[model samples]
Target chain A: MEKKKIRNDIILAVCVLAASLIALAVFLCVRARGSYAVVLIDGKETARYSLSENAEIEIKSENGVNTLKIENGKASVISASCPDGICTAHRAVRYGGEVIVCLPNKLVIRIDSASNGGVDAVS
Target chain B: MKTKNIAFIGLLCSVSLILAYIEALLPPIYAAAPGIKLGLANIMSVFALYKYGAKEAATVCLIRISLSALLFGNPWSLAYSAAGAVLSLAVMILLKLSGKFSPVGVSIAGGVCHNLGQILLAMMVLKTIGLGLYMAVLAITGTIAGVLVGFCASLMLKYLKKV
Candidate 1:
């Protein structure tokens, strides 16, 4: 390998490591929150619920087919009959900076607040 | 190139389009982030990058994305795919010119660029800067996916060189 290749490899390694660290920190923070509010489309807020340490709560819409879970301040589609099921892969979104959206159902779960907002600036 | 070469490229484009469609069918492996794709179509782009150079690679990618969008994507998805394809091509070209990174590195960079472009487009369309927070995680995931895809391409190239 050329000297330049070695240097580039070093740079790439550093970039990857830095990115991993930042992601880990964000994941940790997202996993730390306790209570979360599940906001419905009609502007009605569900009762603020406390998240058991590492516990996941399932949110089911009237449609029943669209069910999601919120755990550790992260929201994800746990189950959905949507053809693609892309929402389910979104998994648990713990960071306030993240969002879980189901376009077909017009559902969006996002962490929004001053504390959650702080996570975005860390990147 | 001759007509035969053009036909070959056409075949590659068709293969890429089919791969894109298949990828569309693959259930998203995650649940929190909808619309995220593993970018299986990138395999063809990597093949073209190694065999035909940057311009051809770009053309193949463009044709694949456009055709895939028309066939299976929504308007918003079309926009995101376009942004991602363009950014990925640009990164691939830059890496090709630098001549320092391997094809694997170039592909990894392409993946990172693709995600960055997609995230940027998403933020714009949603009119929310809040989405920027996901950039870190997206970048990390993109890099990993890119490396995996790149490794696959490298293996394919190694086999091709023997023939």
Candidate 2:
């Protein structure tokens, strides 16, 4: 019984570790610092701004209000009237593929580099 | 349904909802990741599945998601949580039926599936494949959270029998 229990433990440990390793690899692959910020309201592109040009944007969406601030080549939600305020809680982001989503407001702020092409026909 | 079953299921639903509320109170450990949650409420889902069977588990999950959404979240969050719950529950049921794993294994599987479901929804809503770039991070977090949740459920199963 003890041996069988050990086997179960080993099997589970291996599976979880293997999956995590793969995930870590993928996580590294899709992340890089970017030079622009894109905002989407209700799944539609509403605005785009350069990371180099520091500015604050106030977005009035269907659900509520959010204020996105870009400064020091980093973008963040400085304030939001949404109940959760999760987007505001997110740290200043300067990485490509990093996203801040205000689920309550149906708002998304995505970061991408200005040096490379990112927005595609599907977007 | 019998009166006793209704009361029992209701009690489980309330407990899960309370867990959800408590989870919301906790701060996110990672500033970059918002959706990573302990999913402590899933303890009851696993219990319901093991004790009263899949149908009871499904009922408990459905009520818990709906009530918790009404109490704490907006329409968008409601939609996201509902989709995640459904996919997670379906995966859990399949794992349970396979009979190859324990409650701990089932909960882990459920947790991972839940993250995938939510990620897929987020990608679609954002209209960007870049959203998937962070999925690996979520997968790692989900696995850790899954082990914690699964551990709790296994312990609870040892004591609690019926939903």
Candidate 3:
């Protein structure tokens, strides 16, 4: 019984660890420096800003409001009216394909690569 | 359900709710990871699954999620939690039915699937796939949280069996 339990533990640990490592590798490979921060509300493009500009934009959605700040080529949520404040706690994102999500406000700030023409595609 | 079963489910629900409340009061486990949670409430779900069955476990989980959301979360959070609960329960049930894995394994799968479900819902809600990057971090945290919750649950099950 002890041996079987140990084997099961080893198998599960290896499987989960391998999966997480693969995901981590994918994340590292896909992330790249971004040029624009695109804000989407309810899956619609609401605003876009360049990373070079240092400014704070107030995003007011039907649910609540959030303050997004872009500085030092990174964008992050400075403050939010939502309860969890997960978005505000998220680290600044400057890499393409990185996002700061405010679920309560249905707000998303996604960094897009220069090559992808992220917000430009919407325009 | 029999009165006994219903009462057990209610007890599980309240226990899970209290655990969630305690978790909320605790500080984030890691500053680098914004949304990582201890998932301590999952102990009740695992215990319910082993003690009663999947239906009872799901009932306990659903009630806990809805009540917690009503008390402390917003509508969007409700959506995320609902998605996570549904997916996590489904995975855990399937793993349990396989009989190849222990409660600890099932709980690990449950924890990882829960995070995956939430991230998928977020991606859909935001209309962007970029959030998928966050899963890499969440998966690791989920595993650690899962092991802790699983051990607690297994111990509880062992003690309850004697009772």
Candidate 4:
């Protein structure tokens, strides 16, 4: 009985691992390249920048400040005044519907597919 | 519950809190996935569930999450932790009750659910579903962390039973 229980547990763990790997693969393959970076502060749209144009955007919220850098069709938080700096530590993202959020600063940077003749319309 | 049981649960709670404290001290494992951590404290929760059932496990998990949040986290962190802890414990209890999976399997479910719960909360609060990809990243990390925590918990359970 004990051995059977252990076997069941092993099967369960394997299932979880397999499921996660499949999810990761699906996300990676299905993601479309983003054309724009949309910044929101306190759930309000503050700014929108095209990913094609490499630029640095500084966002200031009531809580803190964050510097978002868009270079080479990807967006990343290069710097931040938030205590944790979690946003700054995040990797750059170019996939449509990907996000980098700074909870401390109430800042959110989202990558969006181009609405005008973009991936969303194709799919 | 007996006084001894109450005292033991309190002890388990403190142990879990210490695990949380140590986890906080460690830097984030992957820069690309900011929330990924060892989830070391879950060992205690899984242990409590196997030893004393759902009620004791929930008590230990809640006290640990609440106290750690109060001591080392802000309001936002508290919200995230509370969401994760509640969902994780509930899933662990349900899996345990199913009687097919061992503690390791149950712990794995707990770990994944915990990450899912936190990510769901973040998505709701941020008002965007763009976190879906991030959730995918976390699911993998959470599964790996779950295996480690479950292994340790199962080992601890073996020794504790001999006591």
Candidate 5:
């Protein structure tokens, strides 16, 4: 390989490594603070539970297709019929960036600060 | 003007459509963000950038996104895809004209631009600035994917010249 090729490879490797470390750090910090909300399909506040205090709380959406379980300061989609089942893999969203979304069902489980002012302005 | 050139562009568009459809089938790794994609179809766009010109590449990119969205049955995705596609194409055009980088560099620039455009659209649609944080992750992934696709395109161009 040429000198430039080697240099580019090294740079790419560094970028990837740096990204992995940053993602890990963010995940850890988010997991450390465990408070989240469960919003139902009917636009009602289905449940607001803190992971730190709850041993295990089951939050069922009004449609009943979506259910979330909060335990040990972590929230996860315990069950859903949303085809892809990606929400289940999301495990628990403890960080500001982590989100569990079920599009077909129009349900979103996100982690936001109580003082973030208000629910996200978009959706 | 040349049949070969036209054939090549056609091939690139078809490849992009295939990539887009394959990506669509991959079961979104994240649920809430159903429309969020890795922009894998960009491989063809990057290829066209070097094989044809930036304008031709942009045309191919737009057609791929539109056709893919139409086939996939999500007109809403068009707004975000178009924003990203157009911005990425413009960035690639500028980079290609600068003569500072090779096709690979242009591809990387295009990928980064695509991610930034998508993030901007997300922030606008979601009405949430928090989505900005996701940009960091997208940038990292975009660059990596760009390099891979760029290298592939470079190889193809090299072979085409030999023929």
Candidate 6:
């Protein structure tokens, strides 16, 4: 192994790492558009509701129950029958790709930005 | 391939499979987020790519994913793993052939490519481009995991060469 090659590799690694970090920083600051909440039960999506809509949904499964609430363009799990209740404790999510998971109940509510500002064609 | 080379590939394959099994037993530390892992098996993949060449590295990666699927994953996971491994291996081979980056750099690129490949597949299956948001956090985590895996591979390669 040439020492020169290793030095070059280190430089390349730093450049890529810096580039990825900038991308992440940009993602954090960007405002999401046309976002919605997706309710997944056992890894399969059960329903999708827009973030622009304010409503409450009670998702009951054999595992347990979780009440997902969308209000003021943000989503949260306000209540659940699961033992952990980590989802309920989580902060309300307004950004795309954020999620509230009721693991004990196998319920996942993830926030996704339609970004295109149009209704999803999957309906 | 020589008999000795074949044996080395087989050895790396089994090692990678064992690493995959061990990784499966770890808790999902990220809680609500899934698919985060130490990727210990990738150490062998990176090492083999740098040491034995692309053919052997590809063999190591394929066998690890296949054997791990048999041990503890379903068909769905097998599909994702295969896609990630293939994409990662392809990028790693390209980087190696270029000799423009060290093993660590190549591993980092491989790690990011693996996540991207899986995310692209998920977007296609879900029929929505929304999955791009998930890639942000994953990108950060993937870089960390890649660096750790790469550093370990660096040490392992040094030892193997001496042996």
The top-ranked prediction according to DockQ is: 4
State the number of backbone clashes in model 6: 1
Q: Write the per-residue lDDT of candidate 3 for residues A14-72, one digit (tens) a residue.
A: 78878878987886887679989989898888888999999999988887999999999
Model 1 agreement with the true structure over B54-149: per-residue lDDT tens digits:
888988999998888899986657777899889889988888777898667777788878988887776654444545445666667777777777
Model 2 chain A: weakest 10-residue lDDT segment is A114-123
Give one digit per residue, the lDDT tens place, for model 6 in B28-92. 55542445667889999999998889998998999899989888986767887888889889999
| Local distance difference test, each candidate | 0.67, 0.78, 0.84, 0.84, 0.66, 0.78
Enumerate clash totals for all models, in the order shown. 11, 3, 0, 0, 6, 1
For candidate 3, the per-residue lDDT at B99 reads 69
Tens-place lDDT digits, model 4, residues B64-148:
9889989998888889988998998989998899898888788888888998999888877776565766676777778788889
Candidate 5 lDDT over residue span B21-128, tens digit each: 988887665433323456678877877777778778887898898898799846546776787888889988886776556666667767767878876865555434
Superior candidate under DockQ, 2 versus 5? 2
Give TM-scores for every candidate, taking all chains together and pairing residue i with residue i.
Answer: 0.71, 0.84, 0.88, 0.90, 0.72, 0.75
Docking class of 2: acceptable
Q: Which DockQ values do the candidates obtain, in the order shown?
A: 0.26, 0.37, 0.50, 0.59, 0.19, 0.29
lDDT of 4 at A99: 83
lDDT of 2 by residue, B1-163 (tens): 7898788888988898899899978876654476788898998898888877899999888888888889877777788888889999998998788676677777877887888888788777765565664566666677777778877887887876543
Alpha carbon deviation, residue B100, candidate 3 (Å): 0.7
Off by over 4 Å in 3: A1-9, A61-63, A118-123, B1-6, B29-34
Per-residue lDDT over A32-82 for candidate 6, one digit per residue giving the tens place of the 0 to 100 score: 643788887776778999889899988888788888889999998999996
- Report the lDDT of model 4 for residue A47: 81
The residue pairs that clash in candidate 6, if any, are: A9-B102
Model 2: how far is A10 from its true place, Å? 6.0
User: What's the best-to-worst order under DockQ?
Assistant: 4, 3, 2, 6, 1, 5
Better model by TM-score, 3 or 6?
3
- Pairs that collide in candidate 5 are A30-A94, A30-A95, A51-A73, A101-B32, A122-B126, A122-B127
Candidate 1 lDDT over A15-106, as tens digits, reads 97597667767666665442443333322333333333344455555533566565555566677755555667665655333556554444
How high is the TM-score of chain A in model 3? 0.85
What TM value does model 6 have? 0.75
What's model 4's TM-score?
Answer: 0.90
